[model samples]
Target: LTVGPPPTPIPNPQVVATDFLEVNREELQRWVRGEPGAFDWSPFIQHVCKIEGRGEPWQEKERRLRGRLRRILPIDVHCADPLGAPLRPPADALLSTFCLEAVSPDRAAFGRALLNVGSMLRPGGHALLLGALGESFYLAGAARLPVVPLDEDDVRGALSDAGFTIRDFRSYAMPPALRTAVDDVQGVFFVHAQKPLEG
Candidate 1:
């Protein structure tokens, strides 16, 4: 978290985050500008610092993060250029958590979504993706959104086809106690992959 901002080695680093929905983008902007009704991310930051056993005060870390966040733009992961317009040169890395599967209706769409989002990064850039494996359909409020059931092989194949070289792939099974009828999420997968040097 203390690393310099992506694609930049300069001292004044900044983060450019994006969301597909205007509402979501606004929410982040609200938080970034400290508007009313903004969520407090202090506890989450504190927890992460505790886990990392870092000596730096969590408040200091939070300040650094807020300072780094300069923009919250809109993005469409299904589009060729997710950001729709040029913001800056390609980023060095991206981190996605439980997004592509939730937005995609099927396996093919999932792969396409990955490729689209990955396009935002420069060649040889890396990605840390955390997503579900097997057993689809997650409950968002009263709505049950369909998810493409994907296993280890499916993820590997999709990454391969997308031109990502998988550095590591880890899976964690759903514990019985946490499993519920609301969502049939069988397991979760975490992958650290890198694109080729030449785009």
Candidate 2:
């Protein structure tokens, strides 16, 4: 089952009403925000500072940016699978992208996981992702996960083998927490690939 605000948040995106799989709000928020994964650390750091100051109530205001991105792009969701395997969705599905993250510094596994996610999408579907390219740092719940950096070339090669056409592959910085200064992080590569309709 799949339903929520439409893939594209438009004039009247309505909350979908479906009864298939469970739609826990907590899980949805985690996926929407990419939590415990690619996230900002500034707020967390600030929160810790307050903890040290004791029981004083502090008003932390969240800013909501109002703007419009003038693009009618396809909406996508990525399931970080190691092997390029197909995932079955209900017929009413609206998402267009599935993905994996195989560019870990280990090189022990290539884009297998990411490829697995891509295999489930319909042809012409798109995806966006953050990959580690030549980066050697990461943190897992206070424990450090050793990472070795992989370059853009490596990412492309894996996606190609998984039957995806490279749409826009680039490098991007991980959230502050992923950086060594904030904690201990190494390096990473970013990519966006698609399954061609003509395939």
lDDT of 1 by residue, 1-199 (tens): 1255575565776788887889888888887887778988889999989999968899898889888898888888888778886547787788899888888888998899998888887888889999998868988799988888899898899899899999889999999999988889999999999988972
Poorly placed runs, candidate 2 (over 4 Å): 1-105, 172-179, 182-188
Cα lDDT listed for each candidate: 0.86, 0.45
TM-score of each: 0.90, 0.47
Off by over 4 Å in 1: 1-10
Best by lDDT: 1
- Model 1: residue 73 alpha-carbon error in angstroms: 1.4
Give the C-alpha lDDT of model 1: 0.86
